[model samples]
Target: MGASFFSFSFSMVSFSSLRSSLVPTRMMGVEGQWWRTSGNHWRAEGRDDRMRGENEEDSKLSLDFTSEEKMEIESIKTYKKDLLDDIQKLKMEIDSVMAEILSFESAEENKTIERNKQFSNGKKKFNMDPKKGINYLVEHKLLDKRAQSIAEFLYKEEGLNKTAIGEFLGEREELHLQTLKAFVELHEFSDLNLVQALRQFLWSFRLPGEAQKIDRMMEAFATRYCDCNAHVFQSTDTCYILSFAIIMLNTSLHNPNVKDKTTLERFISMNRGINNGEDLPEDLLSKLYESIRNEPFKIPEDDGNDLTHTFFNPDREGWLLKLGGRVKTWKRRWFILTDNCLYYFEFTTDKEPRGIIPLENLCVREVPHPRKPYCLELYNPNSQGQKIKACKTDTDGRVVEGKHQSYTICAASAEERDSWIEAIRASITKDPFYDLVSVRKKKVINQTPQD
Candidate 1:
């Protein structure tokens, strides 16, 4: 298939529009010293001393577990690992067979191929009789307006040495390639209307991050998910519309909460009787088209990070530019800062943590007059025992610089930097019991009344 026919529009918003749309909101009700257990679960240890004293007995009594219960827990753990392994195997099989999944070529594609063959034959004839072909091309207005100047330059200036003519044709090919790229960009921009509409739906549910995540998801879907480079579609509009449905279906499958009406499961169930690629139900396709166009998005609350129940009470979570380890290039990463650790996500929409940085025994300092002004440094006490992929080290497994591993982190602004720095430091030196004592003093003072 020709590149023009095969290419489907992937919409993208302007940089200014994107920036204006996604403004990070301040995290609310975030203050507290959270307790981390060995199981990596976070619990509210209580905000003050009086609250801690009240809950102490309840906490201590919960720690007792019987032998039978412990054995049952071990069995469940083993079962979970087995299930995960099975899931990995299934994913591998899907990836391996993706290329071999046959999809039929349409009548339109066959017609396009025929047209291309005729065009190639015409090009061959044109090369043989240049003068007559040029006059005919001009009369028919078949040539691109941009190609006129190049043609004039080639014949008028550079005389027809076979090498010079070949070189000129190569330049013409480059121009055509550039023109194709421009068409792609134009189509993408035009499709931004749909993208913006989709963004509105996401933002209506307060899921701006989810909307952004879809862009990354689409990129992965286009470039990595399908092994086949060529996607078969009836029309260009149908192509992207179906792609949107696939994305929605993919997201629905991954989410456990999407169980009922208007779900991907329902769509799949309706199409269970038909073959996958060969005979897709037209009614189901119509439903999907309507779903993408008109249906109101029902984003699950679980789309956002649930750090409240985690071992670390995440104070802040947002997209930040992070420098690469090997390439030393900057790229955006979803940063989540907890009391004891800093975690990064591949995308803001990702549920899995990509990397973790323990703040234990690390020094936080400001970087002055750096490439990015709003930057801070985390100096690890020693890189010997710590595993940080970004840090360059010696063969002896020590940091190349010295004993410590220093990471430079950037925030969106100076104010954000200060807040991050303060939160990180407070978590590092925070006395979990200090609040308890302060609360007790306040209670005592209140009990004394007007003295």
Candidate 2:
């Protein structure tokens, strides 16, 4: 009952950890583009593109639905679906049991009468004192060090690991009602292995408990898939481990969006089965401890825009390509060019239609098209992809504003301000259209220009 919540600590920390644990989520492949239908296929950058719509969101299912379903998959759409489903089922069951208990409690006329009813009902609750339960388990030698660490934080000197909890919760609060409710339920029992009991309770509801099980599963998967040369069990900073599992979940046979947050929450909520609180119906932080052993994470959002696309730029990290003095990005050119700024791709006299053409900062991008560009765009040997212009940076690898909005033209150079225009014409000629070039780089970012 919210009334019995007298005076106890709440764990804002659990919520904080849950949020931080979401580090390194997953996402889709490149986006943006216009296309045309060719027979049953769609053509973009000149390649045979595949369809991703499982089977028309409203169409008849084929016998080979799974394979047909995999089309247009970013990377891990199916796996997330199943995982989330399992979690959802667990959550509902947990909710059912808690609701039953609360109903029985509420039926009583008074606090003592309610206690009597609960006792008669044979359902025990954990005592309100967190340290009592933790120390009880420790004295019985039932808890390992990690469990003890969790225990030490509970009912700690600061009336709950307020400092550490604050780091996780990111705020200070006297008591989180959700944590208090959980603590009150936990305090009524004496012989239970709190951690193990939590595990069994979660599984009863369909969630992961026992930090060991999640660690082992994650460790094994990481070695095979991520080649992560690290032991998950060795440390509590399991962000890397969780990130790896998420990658696997995304890469699994039946993955959904690896970054699907609802999918992640639903799966954990349903399968691991932490009973919902009568005092606290929502606020995921209440169930965080029960789910965090495997370091549960937040699924990444699907908003596709201004992404951090990584690439190696040969010219400079701050430099960018500008066309007519304006930066002409295909979809987004966040990645730096891996090759150097100015390179000469010379055409020899022996080569047909020969004229020495210099190629500098030619970047190959995914373009507005998702499918590969049509190869026909490069029918001529002298022809390169569409040339989007680029430029060098100032002292600190910063893109200069002067050239950002400028354009390049052959005749405009007579004014001295049209140097970029002059460069564009010189970059291409009889080739009809310039080829789209891609520069290699380390990686791109999903951030806006801060300064």
Top candidate, metric TM-score? 1
Least accurate 10 contiguous residues by lDDT in model 2: 436-445
Full-model lDDT for every candidate: 0.45, 0.29
Off by over 4 Å in 1: 1-314, 381-404, 432-451
lDDT of predicted model 1: 0.45
Error of 1 at 377 (Å): 0.9
Candidate 1: tens digits of C-alpha lDDT, residues 1-451: 5654445322223433423442223212123433333443323343332234435533432453345544553464366457657777998999767644532245567777876665454445444444444344444444444654435433333222322233223223455334322322222222233333333323222211122222332332333212222343322222333445443443444434446435544554433322222334566465554555353344324334431111113257777776655456776778887656777777778666666777777867777644778988777656645544333334454544322245667889886786577557655643322343233333433342221
The true-versus-predicted C-alpha distance at residue 92 of model 2, in Å, is: 58
What is candidate 1's CA lDDT for residue 152? 46
Off by over 4 Å in 2: 1-174, 177-232, 238-240, 243-252, 256-451
| Per-residue C-alpha lDDT of model 2 across residues 26-65, encoded as one tens digit per residue | 2222232322222323222211134355355324223212
Worst 10 residues of 1 by lDDT: 203-212
